[model samples]
Target: MTFKNTLEFAQKLDAEDKLARYREEFIFPQHNGENVIYFTGNSLGLQPKSAKRYVDEIMTDWANLAVEGHFYAEKPWWDYHDRFAQKLAKVVGAKPAEVTVMNTLTVNLHLLMASFYRPKGKRYKIICEEKAFPSDQYMISSQVRFHGYKPEDAIVEIKKREGEHNLRTEDILNKIEKVGSECALVLIGGVNYYTGQVLAMEEITKAGHKVGAFVGWDLAHAAGNIALKLHDWQVDFAAWCSYKYMNSGPGNASGCFINEKYHNLKDIPRFEGWWGHKKDERFLMKPEFKPEAGANAWQISNPPVLAMAPYLASLELFAEVGMPALIEKRNTIVAYLEFILQEIDKEVPGTFEIITPSRQEERGTQLSVFLHGQGKALFDYLMNHGVITDWREPNVIRLAPAPFYCSFEDMYNFGQILKKGIQDKS
Candidate 1:
């Protein structure tokens, strides 16, 4: 498709967008009087318009039912988390039985590691990507320590080739093979939080399994951004937070995937609780621990219905507009954003460098731009000018043209703001 940098071209794309009608569904942040051109959905998604109604319903139910709300509420608190499983299973590409909504992201990560990260004898090393989100690093270090091993010895990070921003698929696969029998688990993010690089999850899963390592993904950035096939690809387990791409509000409950094979694996030691007890026997307060089948077996406590409400609202929108539509819109928006970026780069050489991959399949809608000789000043300029994007560490700006709520006009305006910022800085 031919590209142009004119406002008319941008407007034309917006006019033709099939998903344009969904833009009003989100409540964007305001700057001065106008809504900011939000490009931080990769960090925190905008609130869905129906979020209040969802939460209000729960509040009303609680007021009326009191303690009986567990079985009597609009959405029964007893089975509240179960409501998202079928929908979420579709999102992460898993069977309904294999997926469940549980605690927050890191909590689910720790829970999954507890069940899957059983370091035995010499086969105790774990592999992850370098520069993974800090929480993951801390979690891995703590887990290894709990298992009586030093992090430096038990954790093997797959690093990028010298000076490269993203780790190559072959490099990660080779690392798995090199670790071989000593590799007990391969846990990595589906998308690198900083670089916006989408890893080859299927290949990675296969490589780990080939070497007798349990494979899993931290899909915080990938869950709602890209199409995944966790079940089809035979991924052992995966977890993701909904606050970002899923627009489930800040620090919402997370979704988890456990391959059906583990549902019956009685040998695996798990951190169990009453919520995970067999549903029929849970109300009876049974002394014996009998876990429910599938991923629901991992639940620690009854889900917080009020907190899960916003997720239901966001997920309902996702169900209305399927992932295929979202993916199509994302591809075009990203292409336009990339086009504008290339033009800006040509106009002001060395001002910034795009670290995200150019290939559509290799990334989501996010593009992480590394400032050359500049710092947060340019980011501040964009923010002050009504462009709400995320900034990372020493010098990187992360912009995401979220498909569900963000518009083509927003991307166009973002490019315009970026161009002006460059011209002013130069």
Candidate 2:
């Protein structure tokens, strides 16, 4: 499909977009009395207007029902989290019994590691990508240290080829094979936060399992942006925050997946709490711990209703639109954005370099660009002019045209602004 940078063409595309009406559901930041061309959903998603209603309902229940809210409220506080099991399972491609909502992303990963990262004898090393998100690096290193092994010795990193910015699937598989019996766990980000590279999760999971290792993913960037098959792929466990493309508010509760195969294991190591005890017998308050049926067994405490309210609000929209429609719009909008960038680059040759892979399947909504002969000034200019984007180290700007809230006109408008910024800087 051909794309044009003209305003009229953009308007036509927007008029044809089925998801265009959904844009109004989001509250965009204002710039000069107009909505900003938001490109930072990969960082923090715009808040859904319905979020307030959801929160108000929770507050109302707390005020009216008081202590009885646990069982008497509209959405009973006791089983509040149960609402998310089916919804979240659909979002991440897992069975209802295999997924649950819980603590923040890092916290859930740590708890999951306790169950899956048991290193015995020669099978102690863990494999992960080089330059993973800082939180994951810290979590993996801390886990390694807690297990009485040095990170340098127990962690194997799959490095990108010298000049490449992305990891090849073959390279990842080769590392898994090379480590073989020594590998105990394979944990990686489903999408590289910086480059927006979508890893081959299914292949990686298979490779890790072949080497006798438990495999998992941190789906921080991948969850709502791309299609995933965690259950079909047999991933041991995975976790994702709801604030990114899912459009939940900042620092919201996380959703997790644990394969059904692990649900029946009685001896799995975990840091259990009262919330994870068998639901039927939870009120009995017995001395011995009996785990819940599925992924809910990993919960360390009761759900934070306030934090989860926004997430539930966002999931409603996701259910209405579904991932299929979202992916269709995502592919086109991102391609259009890429086209606009290419047009701007042609006008100011050598001024921009898109480091993200050109293949649609290899990336999601983000396009991380290397700004040549530009620095923070360009980023600052874009920000001031209402082109909300993300900036990383070494002169790179990440533009994520989130399909649910971003329209084709945003791509065209952003191109004009970008071209002017380049000329002004020159």
TM-score of predicted model 1? 0.99
Residue 207 of model 1, lDDT score: 96
Total residue pair clashes for candidate 1: 0
For model 2, the superposed segments whose C-alpha errors exceed 4 Å read none
Model 2 shows how many backbone clashes?
A: 0
What digit string (tens of lDDT, one per residue) describes model 1 on residues 1-426? 898988898899989999998888989778888889989999889999999999998899889988888898878888988889788888888999999998899999999999889999999999999989999999999999999999999999999999888889999999999999999999999999999999999999999999999999999999899999999999999999999999999898899999998999878889999899998889899788999988989998988888999999999999888888899999999888888888888988888889999898899979999999778889999989999889899899998999988877787788888888878877
Overall local distance difference test of candidate 1: 0.91
Model 1: how far is 42 from its true place, Å? 0.9
Residue runs of model 1 more than 4 Å from their true location after superposition: none
Tens digit of lDDT per residue, candidate 2, span 270-373? 99999999999999999999999998898879889989999999999998899999999999999999999999988999998999999989999999999888
Could you tell me every candidate's TM-score relative to the true structure? Answer: 0.99, 0.99
Model 1 Cα displacement at 154 (Å)? 0.6
User: Where does the lowest 10-residue lDDT sum fall in candidate 1?
Assistant: 405-414
Q: What is the lDDT of residue 289 in candidate 1?
A: 91
